[model samples]
Target: MAIEEKRAWIMAVVTIVAYGTYLALVLNAAAGAPLGEAPYVYAMLWTIGGAIVAAILLNILAAIVSPRDGGKKDQRDKEINRLGEHIGQSFVILGAVLALLFAITGLAAFWIANVIYLAFVLSSILGSIAKIVAYRRGFQSW
Candidate 1:
């Protein structure tokens, strides 16, 4: 697989794992209380930080494992990357709008923060999926 494809896989896995861990932590802390009452800020921050570090480390490992492919990027890679980013950015916009609305309506910070976090996770996963699909099934530029 190309280094980019490997990167996509790493991103997808790391994001999913991190989000799942955050969810587990928050839910466990909530116990029988409301989700908004759960101590989620620290968990969310830590998980996000961890995911970023893990993705970077895994990408470095992948580059070390395949030095020849590490620095290679062609037109296809660029196109696929752009396409994936465009596809993934939809979630970010949606999240921003939702968060803004929640804030305007005087919702709890927990809801707004969770919405943003979920959007980020969804963006990463969807982007990674799009890249992997383009790599595996032949990308077509339109």
Candidate 2:
């Protein structure tokens, strides 16, 4: 497979794993675990940190695999990332808006809220994975 393809797979895998972790955290928090934050806050932060760390580690390892060649991302790579970010942002906003709406109603159970929050995070993760796939499939350029 091509380098970009490999990168996409790596990203998708990490995203899936991160989302899975988030789901587990949400479940644990919902069980009243005194986790640091009410129910989803700490879990959300953990998910963010995990994603950041995984992405950073992947980049670092990719560089170590070929330091000279990995030093810079070409225009195509940059564009793909930009587009992916755009998608991810949409997911975040959608999640927040949904949460706000639910909050206004004041009817959602704690478990429901946690699940909604997790759904939003998963949306972003899936968005990123979709973008990578689109880039690889030639649906997205650069």
Candidate 3:
């Protein structure tokens, strides 16, 4: 697999695991209280930070493992990346709209924040999946 593809896989898996970990911690801490009342800000921040660190570390590991790839990016890589980003960004818009609706409806800040965070996570996963699929199945030029 190309180094980019490997990186995509790493991103997807790491995002899922980090977010899952955060969700578990937050939900456990809620302890039957309303989700809005749970201490989520710290957990979300920590998980986001941890995910960034882990992604950097794992990317370094991936590079070391495949020194021959040398983290090169050609035309195909660029195109695939653009396509993946285009596909993934839809969720961000969706999330923003939903958050706006929540705000207008007087929903808790917690819900708004969580919705935005979930959108980011979804974007990352979908983007990575698109890149991986393009790498494996060949990107179409249209």
Candidate 4:
């Protein structure tokens, strides 16, 4: 597999794992209390930070393991990335719109924040999946 593909796999897996861990921790903590009252900000921050650190570490490890790849992103890699980002960004936009609507409707801050966080997670997952598919199959020109 190309290094980009490997990176995509890493990102997808790491995002899922980090987010899953955060969910488990938050849910466990909130078992007796309401979700809104749970300690979510810290959990979100920690999970996001963890994901970033994990991705960086894993990418570095991958590079060291396969020194030949050298993380060279070519034209195809760039195109695939652009396509994946474009596809994945839809969720972000939706989430923003929803957040705005929720805010306008005076919804609780917890729901809005969670919606945004979920959108980010979904975006990463979908984007990584798209990149992986494009790499495994073939990227067709528009």
Clash totals, every prediction? 0, 1, 0, 0
Quote the positional error of residue 133 for candidate 2 in Å: 2.1
* Candidate 1 local lDDT, residue 64: 97
Better of 2 and 3 by lDDT: 3
Clashing pairs in 2: 80-142
Worst 10 residues of 3 by lDDT: 133-142
Sort by TM-score, best first. 1, 3, 4, 2
77 Cα displacement, candidate 4 (Å): 0.8
Which segments of model 1 are wrong by more than 4 Å?
A: none
- The residue-by-residue lDDT of candidate 2 on 1-142, one tens digit each, is 3345456566667768877897786767657655434466666677768887987788677767875565666677777777777776776776667777777787445544664656556665666686667665776462
Report the CA-based lDDT of candidate 3 relative to the real structure: 0.94
TM-score of each candidate structure, all chains considered together:
0.98, 0.65, 0.96, 0.94
Ranking the candidates on lDDT from highest down gives: 1, 3, 4, 2
**lDDT of each structure?**
0.95, 0.66, 0.94, 0.91
> lDDT per residue, candidate 3, 1-142, as tens digits?
8899999999999999999999999999999998899999999999999999999999999999999999998989899999989989999999999999999999999999999999999999999999999999888879
Error in Å for residue 139 of model 1: 1.0
Per-residue error at 134 for model 3, in Å?
Answer: 0.9
* Top-TM-score structure, candidate number: 1
**lDDT of each residue in 96-115, candidate 4, tens digit only:** 99999999999888889989
Candidate 2 Cα misplacement greater than 4 A, ranges: 1-8, 25-44, 107-120, 139-142
